[model samples]
Target chain A: MTAPDPSPAHPVTGLDDVVHQRVRLGILTITHEARRVEFGYLRTQLQLTAGNLSQHVTVLETAGLVEVEKGYEGKRGRTWITLTAAGDQALAEEIGRLKQLIARVETTSTPEER
Target chain B: MTTDSVPAGADPRRLLSDVRALAHRVRLDQRLTWVALLVLAVATFVAIPFDYVGMDVRCVNGGSECQFSRDGVLYYWPAALLIAYTAIAFCYVRAARARGLGARVLPYALTGAALAVVFTTVWLLARVYLADPPTEPFPGWVMVLDRLVAPAGTIGVALLVLARLERNVALLVFTLGYLAVVLVPIDFGWTIHSSVRAEFIPQQVINGVVLLLGAAGFAIARRRQR
Candidate 1:
């Protein structure tokens, strides 16, 4: 199954999108927990394929939200992923921003629906 | 920190992680404080055999006192070594668990004052007032002991403060109290006095040796505390 691409009309901010966006956030969150994780493990976790995950990972790598190191184990190419320090910072700031957004929306909404 | 692939500007995370690492370092330091003390202690016991021959200075009051026959020697210099050993021990312990800054200061001053007072009191009694009693005016190589007195007291207090770990403070206190049994008086006091080094060695060396043992005992105690 193919995942839908983000809508073209709404472009994501690197800090807001790379680390704050749900999928990239999941990748960073997972990598932050691991000292170093393989690309396959990340793909399996986000229910993403090599190509789709690669696109998101490229965007994150460009933003310095994660670090990807490539090496080979025997004949197979191995790509490892880990959260960069910037990624950890971006995630924390994004998390704070998310909580604030949630709080603001909650305050404006009716209590019974929430 | 890894040399390569470390990203910049993670100050908040970096600070938090560094803080945890610092706390762990402090714990490891506290765990190892005893080792320095042990080395000093072993040096103390091992120094017992090098007692210098005493020069019996006849006092004005009617008693014979003991002192180092030679002016400068290994026994004379041991106090400085002991003091340095002690300072290192206290500093290590403090670095590990930074407690009682004021108490540490107070004892240091008191030890200095005590050394002066003890020296003067013993000197006056032996030299001017008493009849022909053998005694010396000061421990030999007084100039050599320029900074060691503080370390001696520091090691002593370090041992006392950490004595609960070994449960042998009672034995230590008892043994030092028995110094009168051998009675080899050096350059300072009346018929009854235990020279720091004793009749065989300079008193300064004895001070270092005793504190060295205390430091060793401290190591064992601190280890046990963990």
Candidate 2:
């Protein structure tokens, strides 16, 4: 009997495109923990330039995974980010998939590869 | 438009670890517990004057003997605690906003206030109802309740709720230490020998000192974390 290919059913195939990117994932994780986060704080925490962080945030915002609010704190304009219900579920699912992928790799690795 | 596939050579283990680390950092950074401790410490110290002013001589056992009671503390403690809880809630809100994070402090504030109210009511009822039988010993459970409802005890119990809300192990440890200070009897083995009695209440002073120390420790740790 021939072994069937497991690629189609692998955990990697289950990852969410919008949630799995490293920067976007970092943003989601931080926002989920904080409940709400400032754009500037997110940029500083993720070590991304303002423009770069803004672009990633835009993508997440467009994907309905995060919500953005523009307002003024004192006289300065500020933007705040918060995760919606879908965003929360997405982050949770993404983490679950990552864990499964890690477990699969651990179980399949040879002693020499380890 | 889905970018669902993992990038070539991306390590799942490393990604998961990074996410965990970031979440931990955010949790630690968002805590403003030191402010609450400091506010409570100041409130404790401020109550000393009220305790002194409230002291009165009361006759007991059919007027055979008399003793001093700090009646002012009965009225002042609950009010002080209410104000402290409000201040703590306000501070947490302001600090969280400044840091661009959401704070879950309303429950802690409300719980502390409710505990204060309940303890004060129990204490008042005990004073009114239990005072008549001066010669009779209080029941074991009443004695336990009395200790637990003391001003220091109330604060220590409230800190347990604060620790849980913050999800902070250090705060939990501090709460336990504060409770020990409240429950364990200690003697300094020295008293003022002056002809005039000192206005300071020793227990309140000691409780205030412990709170201030805890606040300082938390502040230092937070600074180091940054």
Question: Highest lDDT among the candidates is held by which one?
Answer: 2
Q: Highest TM-score, which number?
A: 2
- In the range B1-226, model 1's lDDT, one tens digit per residue, is 2212223223323433433443332233333334444554555444445333333333333345332332223343345344544554556445432321111222333443355444444444545555553466556444223222322333444344333332344534723432322123222442324643344344545554544564566556666655
Q: Which runs in model 1 stand beyond 4 Å of their true positions?
A: A1-15, A111-114, B1-226
- Each model's DockQ? 0.03, 0.41
Backbone clashes under 3 angstroms, per model: 29, 2
For model 2, the superposed segments whose C-alpha errors exceed 4 Å read: A1-9, A110-114, B1-9, B60-64, B67-70, B139-141, B186-200
Q: State each model's TM-score restricted to chain B.
A: 0.35, 0.84
> What C-alpha lDDT does candidate 1 achieve relative to the native structure?
0.48
lDDT of 2 by residue, A25-94 (tens): 9999999988999998887788888888888899999999999999997799999999999999999999
lDDT of 1 by residue, A1-114 (tens): 999987533111223644544456656665654435578766765567788788888989999888888988669787887778888888777655555554545565797866
